[model samples]
Target: MNALFFVMGCVDGRLVLTLEETADMLGMALQTAYNQIDAGTFPIPLRKNGRKWVADARDIAEYLDLMRKEAREAHDALKRKLAA
Candidate 1:
């Protein structure tokens, strides 16, 4: 299967992204992204380079897939419970 990466403005070289780029790709505010990273609630882990936070696009995509799988499982369980 293939993975989908939603973030743009990146060259074909490195898959790294700045916090701002990650926030834009995630449709959230910059501060919110930072908060999530700090709170350890972000989908993927980030690396701190001196004073900046960076994320890997591939890791983010993988995390999204994992979240989708979890949500689907939860929804299926809920449907089964309701049907019972």
Candidate 2:
């Protein structure tokens, strides 16, 4: 699923995502997401909501945007280096 779509859907009044949604947005298996949470490596900051983990939709969107920006910058740099 497109990360922007997922995030925008949530931004329409839904401020948090369940662990499963978070995993899908990150393109990781649910188990892997849980493992990452346990290992303290989940890319988006999460918080405990009763018995489940929840993440802010805005945080996920911001993280994805940052990653996309960095990737684009890296690709541009590589092109420049290759052209030189």
Candidate 3:
């Protein structure tokens, strides 16, 4: 997970990330992020707060962790295959 996300302030007792922050975390354009949200294809769930979309910080962190674990496992499998 990104260190920037960890330092984000909380809103209403929950650590939530703005749409821009979520886009940055995912390395996508702001417009792309909006499109993904509308299409319901974003990896992390989001909800509209007033006029903007926000995602739970914990959810983003968990998704990142899961992606990292999967990538590491795939790399290890490839290495084992090559060694054999």
Query: Which candidate has the top score in TM-score?
Result: 2
lDDT winner among the candidates?
2
Better of 1 and 3 by TM-score: 3
TM-score, candidate number 1 = 0.68
Q: What local lDDT score does residue 71 receive in model 1, on the 0 to 100 scale? A: 92
Off by over 4 Å in 1: 5-14, 49-51
List the candidate numbers ranked by lDDT, top first.
Answer: 2, 3, 1
Better of 1 and 2 by lDDT: 2
- The global C-alpha lDDT for each of the candidates, from Candidate 1 onward, is 0.74, 0.84, 0.77
lDDT of 2 at 14: 77
Residue 58 error, candidate 1, Å? 1.2
Query: How many residue pairs clash per model?
Result: 0, 0, 0
lDDT tens per residue, model 1, 1-84: 023434432425458888787777667899998788778897667898779998887876676677779899999999999999
After superposing candidate 2, which stretches have Cα over 4 Å from the reference?
1-6, 10-13
Worst 10 residues of 1 by lDDT: 1-10
Candidates sorted by TM-score, best first: 2, 3, 1
